[model samples]
Target: MFKSSHLPLEHADKKSWASGGASSSSPMEYPTPLNFYEKPPMFDVKLEQFEQSALDRLRILAEIESCSARGRPWDETKRIVSTLCQKHLRLSSNTAGGDLGIMDTQKEDERRKDHLSHFVLRLAFCRTEDLRQRFITAESTLFRCRFEEATPAERTLLYESRDFKWVKVDDVEKKSLEANLRATLTGFKNIAEQNDAWDRDAFYKVQWSQVPQLVEHRRVFLKKGWAYVPARQQSAIVFREFEVHLRQALNMTNRAMPQMDEDTRLTPIIDHLSQGFLAGVASDWQYEEGDDTTKLRAEQVDEYAKKHWPLCMRSIHDQLKKDHHVKHYGRLYYTLFLKGMKLDINEAIAFWKKSFQGGKVTEDKFNKEYRYNIRHTYGQEGKRANYQAKTCVALLTGDAEYGCPYRFLAPESLQTRLQISYADQGLQSSDIHEILNNKKGSHFNIACTRVFEITHAKYVKKGEGLGQSETVTHPNLYAERSIEFETKKEGPTKVTSKQEDDDLEGIIMQVD
Candidate 1:
């Protein structure tokens, strides 16, 4: 539970958050590395902090889903998830680091963020059945990830903090179950080869149904209806318990959500976070010209679109090449994405002018019809709104010609492009089938992320973990990540990181 250090429970109001004047009087305690998120924090959060915390947590969970989708080994998954947690959800133990006073403050702050973010995401994800299931799986996996890294003392602290109610297998019962335990020790070759440190091995008895994963994997010694889970495999029980509690909590949150619908200030952020998760890369961070890695030229559009563009932009590029014209929305879509790719206004005008000229448009006509809108998109005209590239979420509801190909293109057309057209840079036949399966399930962005990885395989080194940046939420993000991964050899991985900026006025997040 979060300490009421920042706000008094009686006077806790959303007004204080809007004014940003809350102060901490006392410190909070996290006590344990793992959390069940069983209690909702009563503290207030500023709008920005609320949004940022949910986004940070969402990134970690999104990466967790990606790891399983990609079939990463547990060690690799843990390593990748651990690194991501350090960045977004670091829950460092009390004994390992320096300066207890300062470090404890930071750790408690991190835990506070963790607690609130979990509940915030609950509110965001509880709106739909799919969302609830996803939240349960991701949150449970996150708990398991942390539990695995917890020290023995930290584990003890966790048991003290929460009543998991798992019964310990006493030494008498342990000896009685020795034959069954050895029988289920499938991970080992023979009983004689097993270690002699019998006193060190610990076991807990739980209902067999509580940990079907351990039972199915033969990792636990089962008798009658009880599964005796070893200390080393306790995560299975913990994960199952976390998942069960979360599923029930989501239902409760959903039933209590009517009041939330009236809070217009919060619902949009919640919806935004939900949409980002569905898109497989939840972020509100806007990109800027300063974030661009390459000085893209007009001549490079064709080559780059062929080599580096995601399916959405690549499909649009293909349309422009074939017809020398795209409809209004299609042109707008391509222009904004190109702008995000850091194609200078002059080069953008040049690229469009040349492509359109090949069909019906003369220079004068191109200047009159297309050039101003391109300039308008670049913030040189109209309201100077500086429209952003349509994210994967936005693309789903936008024009089919300009939208994500996975969502818009016919199954036959998508298969042709993936298997026949982009196969050189994209997926193998089996990879195409797997991605198409995701597409069938309406996980369009996940399918796009899969395509991006396959096509850009040369840029990705081993252990190139998936993070928000690597997931294809926006067409520009796809291009940016492609460029970043290709060029970066040894620097810290910006491979899955997004650029943060205040220029979100142009953010095109209005999706259904």
Candidate 2:
């Protein structure tokens, strides 16, 4: 009954044809477009149900975040989610439940439902109760400290000396403070552009500087007041307590509330808004490859599905491979999602066509250049452009699991990373020169994100010999390029939020 605007043929209509044993040889017919030649963007989530589904999926993601971050392993969480998918989300099983082996009689008409009733109970066993108790104690202390910091000051000083009644001289911090302001501005901008998914209004409003203010101008009431030390810290404290309550609520409804952030201006909003989306994407109808051959009995199918469940979700399994690339994971996960969405190759082509609007490609041009490319990528009789399309979609979706799509580097950070890499590796200037100047030699930032792709090389044995290994590639081998400087000893020690520290404390408590 649920029909996407991009593909409005009813499920019943689809099922009718499917029941009659439709195959690629005997495909069901549908309407031809009036102007496929005009080349409009092929796909849009035109259906309200689709948007609602996206939102519903986001809600479930919040639940997953709250649950998994508390102590649950991704494997366990994924398994439960996979089970839910099989029961309700009606994707047919072709081979066995865990893999797509030689296509064995595909089952049509089965849809999986998300009945997440036991999500909370599972989370309860995810960690020991003792660990929960210690987390409560530590987080309680943090909550108290944060709250105390937010308390109103005992004395309030009015900035109204008769001579300076219009404004307070006390607020005149030196221009040097501009550096801090700039850093804050830049940090917020980077986060918003890269991570935050919600609309701009949710985070902040930029204001232009206005000079020569007139008296009694209500809009320009920039007050000069010192923030009391105690009160200044309480905002984060208050929000953190709220986070704990969310954890305790356990039920999905409580999880759906937007996460609270500590910064009044930006960081909190950016993290939560994007995380809300990330979580949403995580919770959409669980997808798994399953084989349900009629040759196998119902019990046999169930056993098979359970036994090979991990393989069916190979997107998760490939993480263990030495040469596992994050982009590949991003591509794999996204491709499967598109496939699960029931988007046919032609429909997918249409979607990409729309995505590249305002480009040089008209319909005819796109068809000649990229149309077959997308088709072939999605396992259709098209070309390799489909594979390239997956990468583009991954970049658009902001799955940093594959690395940043946009080239986001603060020049200073890049410079520092380059210096560090060279110094740490003891590479002489001549060595650097050789890499830069040699036409055949390549320059590699040991910290570059592309290192993930080379991990597949791990499985290949080194040299012409039988089995001597060379180097093992892992996450650590790819250095973090972001420069982190040590703050002055007198400066505040870095403090992580209760949400982050809870897991550590819980682990310790469990051990105790």
Those runs of model 1 whose alpha carbons end farther than 4 Å from true positions after fitting are 1-28, 97-100, 185-199, 282-295, 358-367, 426-428, 441-443, 457-469, 480-512
Instruction: Give the TM-score of each candidate.
Output: 0.82, 0.18
lDDT for position 481 in model 2: 10
lDDT of 1 by residue, 1-512 (tens): 22233323232345533233223334445666677776766666766777778888998988888777667798877887899999877787767565344566666677778887887788888988988887887887788778878888888777777767689888888888787765554455554545543447778888999999887877887778888887767767777877888888889889877867666667777787887776766444354665444578899899988877887888879889999988776777777778877788999999988898769888987777677777777878866775666777777756666777898788878888787557787467777788877777667877877777677677653234233335566677677667666666454323234533223334322211
Q: Compute the lDDT of residue 236 as modeled in candidate 2.
A: 31
Clashes of each: 0, 33
Give the TM-score (vs. native) of candidate 2: 0.18
Kindly report which residue pairs in candidate 1 clash with one another. none
Model 2: C-alpha RMSD to truth? 27.5
lDDT of each: 0.72, 0.27
lDDT of 1: 0.72
Write one digit per residue (lDDT tens) for candidate 2, span 1-512.
01122223222323332223224343212111000011111222223322233234333333333333333464544544444334433233222243232221132112111111112112221134442343343223323332332213211211111111122112234132423322322224465552332122111111212111211222222223321111222233234333444346433322332321222332332233333332122211222223432122322222322222111122222331223222334434333334333345555565445534554446786677555434444555422222211221122234444422112233354344334333433334433333222111111111121122122223222120111211111111111110011111232112222111011111111100
